[model samples]
Target chain A: MSRQAFSWGRLPAPEQRLIKLASRFDALPTTTESLLPYGLGRSYGDSCLNSGGVLVGTRGLDRYIAFDRDSGVIEVEAGVSLGEIIELTLPQGWFPAALPGTRFVTVGGAIANDVHGKNHHRAGSFGHHLLGFELLRSDGQALHCSPTANAELFAATIGGLGLTGLIRRASLQLQRVPGPWISGSSERFGSLAEFFALSAEAETASAYTVAWIDSSATGANTGRGIFIRGNHAEGPNSTATPKGIRLPITPPQSLINPLTLAAFNALYYWRPAAVARDALWHWQPFFHPLDAVQEWNRIYGPRGFYQYQCVVPMQDAETVIGEMLQRIAESRLGSFLVVLKTFGSMAARGMMSFPRPGATLAIDFPNRGAPTLALLDALDALTMAADGAVYPAKDARMSPTAFRQYFPQWQAFARHVDPRFSSSFWRRVTETEVT
Target chain B: MRRILIMGATSAIAEATAREFAALGDALFLVGRNPDRLTAIADDLRLRGAAQAETWVMDARELNAYPALLDEATQRLGGLDTALIAHGTLTDQIAAQASSEMMLAEFQTNALSHMVLCTELGNRFEAQGHGCIAVISSVAGDRGRQSNYVYGSAKAAVTAFTSGLRQRLHPKGVHVLTIKPGFVDTPMTAAFKKGPLWATPATVAKAIVKAVQRGKPVLYTPWFWWPIMQIIKNVPEAIFRKLKL
Candidate 1:
């Protein structure tokens, strides 16, 4: 009925801040019992949320602190989103070392999750590129920490779910790109085995490698996928090519479905199976194809979907991924774009941070009621049994047990941060305890 | 808990409305088609501290799917307190004139979709006996201009639907509001120039939230757009036909 609208998830008590210093003062809780800090509110799950306690909004405090063009390093307010950073840096030929699917995510979010990207196998995670950050401790003290200083806090803060302290600002190393163009190639694979082989081969030559799996397939063809590999192009090849088509608007998700997707895919696959080996392409096409369609996520019918992204060690990928897909298909929960990427080394050792030397699979499943949740639970178990972890950015459902099993560091992370630091993701994971 | 459902979860206005409610500690249900973006927005809302935030990735234009989705959303969020019907389409005038299919499609998306949404919302809100509905109609709907009458006609219909629903639901304690944004720089109007006066997402969001809180029956986002559109609407047909919007 007419109830007071609360956020769709449980979060810690929140405090809206207009100044940057508020976020930098680590433990500046209104009271001794409350403590939590968040960036631009980008973390998909509660990793950045805290309930009944202090939640520092970083949105108001965004500002470019400093930049070293020679070294390609930038220091900005923690609230600054990657999008903001890119807008300011892209023209200068600097890019984030690692990015999640979207540019709207904040630097603090990237650091808190130690986010990875399509080029994760080659560049590692956002943590690798981070030089230092300002940490506001639970006691309300701002401490500048890096690998060399306050090493524990630094390590703890990275992928620490914002527990160790509020990140006020961060100095991140920027990637130097030759140009804004990428030379790309797309190859279709008939099976998971081929996909894996192609991915491994592409890793050796391409700057970025990603695969789209057909999760609906079963049996011998359970994991047929499409392989996309790309490398940054050196110079402009085309005298007249659109810089890139950014989605002016995202078509309603109804425009895409199994039938439409099938047609779209069929047409998509028909483009010579491979395109410009060394042709110039805008950075948007190379990195964010989905960005082309603004609000493209609406395609999932009214039954919203969950993005299930998990990284299984390469050794266990085939068995674990095969079983995961098998379960999804058995449940009849179809996924439109099933992406597969190889993770490189982890840059940070934060608990719950998802990245490792393995293969990560991401899929979307419309919420088909209890069956979907049950299926996801089963899949989580499978992922954990294989020592795989889930991506916090793309996660809506993952129990505390699953979180604990996957991220053994959760306890330390939770304990180190303010006890009040919580989120919907955290709430869902820890629902039994609070509810 | 304040239970809010954003129908067009991915719309720029919808996203901003979501952020507003989310920042206010409401439980949010993001209903839209792009499950991925909805999921992303849900995560964002969650991270921003929604008491709880979830997504329903469904095509709003598919009326048949509304009841089932609403049932699930109500259960998930506990219940609905407020619903923001923000889904819309700015049909290309040239394309609509060129093809009958395009014209009908625009009407279906802009007009029929709202009809279904309003029907479902009216039923639920009436049954609940208390709720609020804010529909995003365009100022263009004030009077169909030759530039985009197909789209304007559809919005005009929505504006009427919302008005009638408001009249019927007032006795039931449900508040219905019509939001007419004039050239808000949304994804829908990205191609159009700012043309002297255009509102931003934040401006529209702020206005909508204020109106909802203040219980305003209907509001023009920029306020000035009201008189501006009124003048255009009141202009004689002969005179209107001779001028460009």
Candidate 2:
């Protein structure tokens, strides 16, 4: 059942041999091509795509191994999505320690990408909450990976970008919450400086904090957007799962342009609860909002898109963000879905996990070929000059040198990558020279 | 207030269908070959709000143990409202063609085992005079094609057997449902390339639960399968035998 495998952003849809593994215990689907474990295809870039190889689709391995309601420790097959975990555990007053913006991501994808969520400032990356996992190599060796045992392999698999081997099953340490509701708040920031100020203040007060910058804003309005923060609701309780409406079709061309971006930003910045001094929000909207539109990526049309996320040091964050915004404004090619957040000062559990102590900015742009590539490279230069790093999970075309710079342990990590497994991203970054 | 028994409980479709019943607070007794998977599923069902989630490990093709297995599951759960027989394999047609042992073994697993379970459950339900028996057949059974006639013929036997069972049980206050799922994306069919016609296990499981609840005798899951199978069933042999399906 081989077909063209497309990532979430629909960029670089590669012709892949899709071998679905129904049970974790079963033998790997025999293939002459290199293999990469694929769960949910939630990675936004070529990191999940294996061109001229086999994509072992692990979604069919969705199963629960063990769960202890009292201890809040749950073990599940790698293919199980974070959304399903919440559904099974929330009623018991438990939830994953960290989750990305989308709940559709699989547990294995979360681990491999080392995804961080709104509470990253408090909880750290997903790999930090991992208890252990079974790493199935192509040669039929199931290695138990954790901090205390096979520590190097554990670090390599986390943010390893599916290179180490196939993650069969993983046990996660779930965090206990009061209930499913969140006490949220919102405010407007006038500039990049003001946004940082709000972030510092909310650091100790709120468990979850993130901001949206109007990417189209320039000069006097640079970085002016809405600041949002939330904490688990201790008083009110509501446990309703949000219903989703799908984007049924892909349009002929991009629906996002300068005009639409401006309009959407203005309306979204002043959206309902823009000044809700006190708001009790359901977990879904408070966490995963864009998921309401099931295939929202189709709005970018046939060419697909790229999500460029970079992190700069906290000391020089304001200046760098302002410069980046000014450059983006000059190009007049940015969307309204810009995310700004600050990472906590915590040592990474995985060697290549993206989050570090810094201010991170994520911007989206529809693929316009050479222009988009040039703009992204220019931005990468700015980030590298400021001793910053670009997130590999969100990148499709970051230079190989930059990847080596961002993840200094790449050479060491390369020593552990399963010989039988590789990805388009791996080849693009390492130039396919593993030795 | 239903006590459900799931055979081949580890199948993706059976697991999803059991989740629906578990969410409704029904008691479920699951039977499967893999003891570890069965235990895990039972535990999952309990956490999903099932009043009682129990497990029995038995290979579905172990025909000699059918009566004892049914008796134990019923005794453990007090009674049974529905019995869902959903265990089968998608044996490679080419391999089956090469080995007679493989072909008959597949028949034992896909058809004969189901007939025995249905007969035993049928007797229990008839005596109780109120129960539902739903077995997952396939639309491939509607007409055998050269590509998968062995698997198709086995399913055809199950479909025909359940059709008669439906009529026989109707007068005894029992309901027999024959489910024909077309191109489901289960492990049994994982090797096949999925297309617009393929349905997810959850989708097929949803229809099965709804049909049993409504006491329907025959169901072509996804509803559209009914029309599609109708057209295939009527394709004249003169043209059908010549064309590869």
Candidate 3:
């Protein structure tokens, strides 16, 4: 069967021939069309998408292959989502060493993107906890990849954007935690400099740390936001995590206009915060706030939105971020959702991993066509000038020159990409640039 | 503990339904044709909070083995209060028409096996004084259409058997749920193009779990199928014969 595949950002994807794979042994179709192993469409951009080719949907391979509660080690089909793993292991007092903001992403998606979470200051990206995976190639070889085995492919496939081949199954080292509860706290920072100082303090105090920036604030309050941090709580938790309610219907048009965006950002930052100062949070709320409202992405409506996330060097983060925020505040085209966090000195295991020693900033801009695209371009220019890289998983329209500049190792990573596998993002950057 | 026995435990809907039961902290004794698949499912169920999971390797069509399977499951789990039969083939109508052997084989798998299991379980549950049996029948059984009457006829038989069994066991405090699911997206129907009418295994499983809990005797999964089936079933034969349906 064939269907049009759209991404999480509601960007229209190209028509794709659909192939359903149930088992690890399922053969890739011998057709000449390119094939990409597509898990949940959780990625915000074209990285998880294929155009005029086949998308091997991995939904059927979702299974826990092996688990050791005692050792906190799990072997799972790459198709298994993080949410499923948590459901299975959390009761046994184990959790993924690293987790993205949303739990909907499959383990394969996490590996393919090398997703970073709030714990980037401590646990690093998802690649660090990955033990190994079985890579099924078009040539019919199932190679076991890890730091020791098929090491190059291991590095390439992690953050490889599903271009290398299909990751059938993977083993991960999970961290042991007390329960499904987080000991958390938050305090507002007055300025961009204060945020940098406070995030450093929060990182030292807690395992998980991230901040919400008020991009609408200007001048003295340029990067003012909330610095929130948490660690797994000790002892029992009486409060139960409420089941997240889904956005049942998509609105006719984008609800996040400039008026609403500015209002939301102001209220989010300054409203006499109701959440307790030293609250014990359910891990669900502490980690996956947006996931709770399933399909909240559709609220951006048919035109969709673009998520711009980039990591600049920690050396000049404040100046770079301040300039970017000032530009956004001046333009009045900012959004409600803005996040800032820092990455530790630990390098990502992926050869093309996006996370580095940097202070990262992410914002969502509702697609206003050329205007939004131009804004995204300006943000990219600032990031590149500061020698930072835009996260491909979060980008829809990054320029080829910018991509090459951002990921200088793209040439090396290109050598390892499977001959028969490619993605829209890969083609957009390389094909257009080369041609 | 919720002790449940799942026959054809590796089928998509069965596995999805087993997941629901596991989340309820059920102790499961899973029966399936493949050892590797069953072991994988058992372990997954254990991780999903099934208090304990045991597996037996045998196809559900092996009717003779079912009694021993039941006894083994009852002995292993201490008791069994719930059983879901969610195994069948959507036999290729063209292939079945060409071979009586293929047609009978499909009947044996889709009908006779389910009927025998129901009879065995009905006796056991009636003797125990309480239990719930959920057998997945198809909406195609309501009125046999030309395209899939072979498979539909078998489901019709199973549905009739389940209905009679439900009446027989109701006085004895047993719940027999005959599931009439419309098109479901499973490996069984992977080749067919899906439309708005299709329901996911999880959706069907959830409705089955709800009906089983409420002791409902009949269920048209997704609820909307109930009216659609009613319209189809009420189509008079005189006019139905003129149409290609």
Best by DockQ: 3
Candidate 3 — which pairs collide? none
Model 1 per-residue lDDT at A193: 78
| Candidate 2 lDDT by residue in tens digits, A1-435 | 344436877875877877788777777878779999898887889999998899888887677778898999999989999999998898889989998999998899999999999999999999999999999998999999999989999998998999999998999999999889889788888899999999999989999999999887778999999998998877554555778899998898889987888888888877775777788888888898899899999899888888999999999999998999999888878887899999998777988888998999998998888998899999999999888999888989988888878887888999999999999999999984423
User: lDDT per prediction?
Assistant: 0.73, 0.89, 0.89
Point out the higher-scoring one by DockQ: 2 or 3.
Answer: 3
**lDDT by residue for model 3 (B80-194), tens:** 9999998788889999988999999999999999999998999999999999999999999999888988999999999999999999999999999999998889888888898
TM-score of 3: 0.93
Instruction: Rank all candidate structures by their DockQ, best first, as comma-separated numbers.
Output: 3, 2, 1
What is the iRMSD of the candidate numbered 2?
2.4
**Which residue segments of model 1 deviate by more than 4 Å?**
A1-41, A48-55, A237-267, A270-276, A346-351, A430-435, B1-245
Interface RMSD of each: 14.6, 2.4, 1.8
CA error at residue B220 for candidate 3, angstroms: 2.0
Where is the poorest 10-residue window by lDDT in model 1 chain A? A1-10
